[model samples]
Target: MKNITFADAQNLKNPIFIDIRSPREYAEDHIEGAINLPLFSDQEREIIGKIYKYEGVSQAKLAGLNFLSPKLPRLVKEILAYKEKGDIVVYCWRGGLRSLVFTEILRLVDIYVYRLEGGYKSYRQEVVRFFETAKTLFPVVLYGMTGVGKTLILKKLAEKGLPVLNLEQLASHRGSVFGHLGLLPQPSQKRFESMLYDVLKELKGFPFLVEGESRKIGKLFLPKELFQRMQEAPVILLELPEEQRIKNLLRDYQVDKIDIKYFLESLQSITVYLGRAKVESLSEDLKKGRFYEFTKTLLREYYDPLYKKSTAYLRNIKKVISGNDIDELVAGISEYWGEFTGRDLK
Candidate 1:
């Protein structure tokens, strides 16, 4: 019966958020760091929902109780383990039956439990609003074609404690046609925003560095405000030779390890833009394992051409940094950043 509003949940010390939603729902999205403690399995949830829709709430409640009765003892045992760790915050899709029932069970054992006031939906609103209206953030966006190790360099920057957010990593896609190769399916938009919020919260102040990205990184759209900030921020182009870029691509993409079908499908996406003849040529190269050659063509005929159009009006290319040496590139980024913010990255 205890309730903690999403806003107040932020101030709780050592809070452990327990998501009692179905597995499918939890997979779609939940509060960050939440542990999935489903009161009903995915199939069990669907059956209950159908009963509620056709039979009515009274019958639905009866069916839900049937499912909970057998699981109650184990659920309490699992919850009791978290006692004394911190305030335990339990929630369901909409602060409904599952979480409340679970909380009531725990309360009987004299264990204090708090439920999220409006469940995951309310928490999602706060996540969206935080991104849409975050404080004025200064972003220094690093720009490069498909390669030039921008993501790798972003990792280096983060390693050195620079405020850096890896959008592609958050989306679980690399932000290219081939971005999804060998990676998990892109997260739901809600899930993407939640992870993005987690990353942004860590670096709330100062000039944070983000890789140059389009409005959509795979299936996830960068929050409107953050994307706009990137477009308007200073850009440091990491220029590299076509050959070197191709080499970098091969190393990072591991094209040989990827399915030829996936690679061809990736090329298929740009057939409209690259034209059928070039697309066929690229596919042929992929089949023959001439990854380096295919990469060069992609950069020149597909990636670079599109990149040019994307940056055509971005006159804010404040500095051009290029080299195979990561240290050199890191130095270039650090120097440009200090110049823009007038503060050294300590």
Candidate 2:
């Protein structure tokens, strides 16, 4: 079997990445685009582990073989479908027996396959090191209160091929107490690191734009290497009138579109800070279809005050753009950054 490092696998043109970990492990995280071709279900893996620990390695091996023998034909059939897609890179948790078996079996049938050396663990290490040592990055941090459309602005910039990092997108969270309001559950910390590493590696020396966020986003923390750079980069304050911000926020949040029970529970979490009387009043506003009033109160009392405390320390205040909506934001960014479209950002 051809043995390759994660670096080699990454550079391989149009490679099919097959993850052969257990379903449970894959559910936690896998290579961003890799296909899950589990070698064992979670229960099977647990049983094998117990047998290996309590019985012996030899007995455990036999049990593993019994489990695999029937699945082999189906596995081969499944893998063969991807034969012409690209070169195959197979990995498990640690390039252990499961992946090795897959590599050998595929090779025996004359399909070119490479086993990832040290597997996902090794790939993860590469990710950690990339951010830890990244010094070539030029960041343009967007500073503004919530609902100022930092994330939306980044999306537009990315569409324009300007380097931009969506930390909120990577974490699959909005970096708030209610960030997960209508979104999927945030990835596990390990999974978040994997996704973060993948995106950062692709950026390579671009003066990317990003939102101003704390060290943590929901359950995930920013890699200190990257966060430190953001802390020092040029800051552009995105200021808009409060009335416009509130209007943008109501549509942006889609608070009424969320699961009512879930939304209420989320608000309940911060009631201690809001006080019981205030919380009850807001709930009544929501139940009575006073979303605008409820949202306006939420912003005035909670989001705005919380955001103002942090803006006092913004570094390298290079410029400020006051605008609302995508077109206006795009024009503001272009006006500020027009001269260096293809060159390195200052």
Candidate 3:
């Protein structure tokens, strides 16, 4: 079994990362592309832990062997399938007995593989270090009121091969009160950072387009250094007519497909700002299927006021592009970026 650092493993050509940890651990976070092939199930790992705590390390080792022995053939077969695709690299929570034993078993079967040194923990440390020290990132932050197509425009710019760091996508939250609506559960904070690191590492030392966001996106917070940089970076404010803004939000949120009970609950969350009476009225409008009116009232009475107040401190406005056409807006942004940086943003 060869030991490899996470950095070296990443450099491997088409490496297939096999996570040899429990399913629960892998579910929380693992190497981004790693597949989970558990050495023991979650309950089995817990059982071994109890043995180690009460019956000593020897008992725990015996228990672990009993749990793993039956699964070896299947696990090896699954890993061998992946090996045909690329070089196999295995990891557990740490470079501990699980990975070591798994790699040894593979060796016995003549299936050589690299074991990740210090496993997931080491990779996580690298992610933390990257966020703390990365200083050369040039962010062209897209600033706009809600429903002005900031995320949509960033996606378009990315399709055109411009570097784009989509924070919302990484966080799995839209950076708003309703950001979690119709989306999967947000990843753990560590998982979010891992995803963010994967994107930022590639865009290091280059200007990347990202939607402007507050420090927190749903339950996840942006890295302190990165958020500070965004606050200080040049901004391009996007605008759309109020009617179009409402339409855009309606389509984006898919109000027709939303659960009414959940929608009402989300509306109540901002009652302190919108007042109980206004929220009740909005909820009624939603229940009545007056989506356009519900959206318009929320924008004018809640979102717009908040957006104006939050952006009041930003004095570094580089340009303001207004339109309902996505393609036109993208072209306008590309033109401004070229003019501002004196380099084509193709």
Candidate 4:
């Protein structure tokens, strides 16, 4: 069993990280791309903790061993299966007893594996440090009114092998009042930062593209340094006709397929802004399948006005790309970015 620093383990080709923490711990936050194979279940961990606190370390160790004895054979077999695919590196909360003992057991079976030196805690510290000191990033921010295809453009750019920091995807929210309507629950703040760090690391030293967003996205907040960098970076404004914008939004939101009751519930959030009477009218339109009218009313009365106010503070507008065709709009953005950065996209 060899002990490896997080940096060294990360450099290992085709490394499979096995997290030896409890399932609940892993669920809260763990290294990205890690597989969880716990040494104890959540309840067992609690039992061990109580023993350690009341009965002392010696008794706690005895209890832990008893619990682990029955699971040893199954655990070794599961790890071996992963070893066949790639190098297996194991870690616990702080590269402590659990990982140390597990690797020692594997050694007895002639299964050599690497142990993460400082565990998930170490990796998390690295993530926090990154956002604290990341200052040289060049972000080409995409700014546009709602339904102007900013997210779609980012997806297309990524498909073409360009660097893109997709904050919305990381947060699992679309960055709006209704952003969470059809999306999965947002990641925890720590997990969001960790995932963001992974992407930024991959795109280091490149001019990555990102969308213009407020400090907060759904329940998560962007790191202050990252938001500052985006604010100071060059901006590209996208435009689409009002009718086309409404159509794009309707498709994006899947208004026709979403539960009307839930949609009406989401509408309640904006009652103060749209007024109670207007929200009621929108609800009626939605019930009657008047999605076009519903979307148009929201965009013109709510989204567009808010967007106008948001952009008022942005002083840097390097280019504007507008078109009815998505492909053409992408081409226009790519062409301008290539000229501005003097880097060929093709």
Candidate 5:
């Protein structure tokens, strides 16, 4: 058996990551893209742990071996598939007994297996390291007022072969007061870093674009190294007309087709900015099915001010007006980015 680091395994042409932790631990948060070939199920693992603590190592080993005896054939089959193809990297919580035992099992079948030296926990430290020193990566920060379509344009840029990281999407957030309303549950911090580490590993030689965001996207804090890189990178600002922004906001908010009650509750937090009269007016519009007017009014009264406050926190931004068109917005920013950074967004 060989030992590998997260970075080394990631750089492999086609490395298969085996997550050997219990299903519960795997479910809570794990290295992104890892497949759980659990060494034990949640209940079985719990029982084994209790035995180890209360009975002794001998009893725990007996229990563990019994659990493994039945699964070994199936597990060996899976390991052989990877062995036939290429290198297989296995990891458990701490690169301790579980992974070592699994690797030994694979080796007994004459399969080459590598265990991560310190498992997922150690990989997270590297992610934190990457985030803390992101300036070296030279990421071009995508800056915009809210609802300016920065994230969508980042998607478009990525589609056109630019290296891009959609941080908010990874975090399942839109990065605003109203942004979290429609988002799915965010990944745990370990999982988030793992996902980040996996994606960044794929971009070795190219410059990448990242959304200019605060350290925290909703609840998950940006990795320290990455957040610092964003702070130092030169910015590309995107703009759009108010009417177009309202239209974009309507589609993005999903209020027309989604549960209006959720949207209503989200708006309550904006009451301070919208004032009692305007909030009542908008609330009544929701009841009356006058959403377009409601959106237009809300943009003018609430979102625009919020945008000003959010952008005030960022610096060194170069503006690219998107006019009333999303395509124009994407094109203008792409062209300028290609020219200024020498990283083609074409």
Candidate 6:
């Protein structure tokens, strides 16, 4: 099998990366855009590993070969399906037996197979390294307390001919415990970076506004470089009155779907601070169609206090813009962005 580097692979508009590892491993992490054409299923790999340890290499090889033999035609068909589109590169956990065997199998069919030199492990290291150094990308930060419509506002700014980098949208997550309330499952970190890079590639070299976020969003962590950049970036705070904020949050949260059980489950994320009885009382209120009371109680008892602490810490770097009335938040965001771009507000 021929070899290729991660840098070269990434530069390809499309490259078929066959990750011949167990599905479990792929689920944990894999190179973005990789297709899992495993040489062994999860359970089979476990059995093979045990056999190799107790009965030695020869016994393990025979068992693996036997398992792969029946699946050979199936594997070839799978590779051809993806291969019909682009150059195919395949690898396993390491530059080890699994991928090598599969590469040879494909080569016999006259397909030029490129094996990743150090395998998925090395690819992961490269991704981590890139993330560590990536913050040099120059990000302008977007900041706001919970439910100020910052996310929706970001979308509006992008629509109005402003350059914006929407990290939260890219991550398929909103950057909070309740962030996943109505969204699809988040992409793996590898996919997140791939999406981030793709977005970054679209903008000219200049300051771009991004929502303020911690290093990790849901199960994915921002690469070290981008995370540090976000932490140090200039912040633009979007503010709204408490009443408007609550109303906007009600729409954002979709109160019609906020059943008591789900509400309690969300509150459970903060059980250490809000005791169980308090949570239960709030839940009871929601069960009786008292959403306003539940939301008010949550804000007074939990969310508002936490937001104050967070805002206090961010005060120096934050540029606060308050009283963004519901009808005006979008236009306000656009005007603010226009000011940054040196354009008269339209």
Clashes of 5: 6
Candidate 3 segments exceeding 4 Å error? 341-346
Ranking by TM-score: 3, 4, 1, 2, 5, 6
Worst 10 residues of 2 by lDDT: 337-346
Each prediction's number of clashing residue pairs: 0, 0, 0, 0, 6, 2
Off by over 4 Å in 6: 155-206, 215-225, 268-280, 312-327, 335-346
Q: Write the per-residue lDDT of candidate 6 for residues 171-247, one digit (tens) a residue.
A: 77777667677778897767677667657655644667787777888888887777776777667777777777787
How does residue 109 of candidate 3 score in lDDT?
A: 86
What is the C-alpha local distance difference test score of each model?
Answer: 0.84, 0.82, 0.87, 0.89, 0.79, 0.76
Model 3: worst 10 consecutive residues (lDDT sum):
337-346
lDDT of model 4 at position 320: 86
Per-residue alpha-carbon lDDT of candidate 2 for residues 148-183, written as tens digits (9 for 90 to 100): 878888888888877788989888888887787777
The lDDT of model 1 is 0.84
Model 5: worst 10 consecutive residues (lDDT sum) = 337-346
Task: Provide the TM-score for each candidate, comma-separated.
Answer: 0.94, 0.93, 0.95, 0.94, 0.89, 0.82
Tally clashes: model 2: 0
What CA RMSD would candidate 4 show?
2.3
On a 0 to 100 scale, what is the lDDT of residue 205 in model 4?
58
Model 3 gets an lDDT of: 0.87
Predictions ranked by lDDT, top down?
4, 3, 1, 2, 5, 6
Give candidate 3's TM-score: 0.95
- Global CA lDDT of candidate 4, please? 0.89
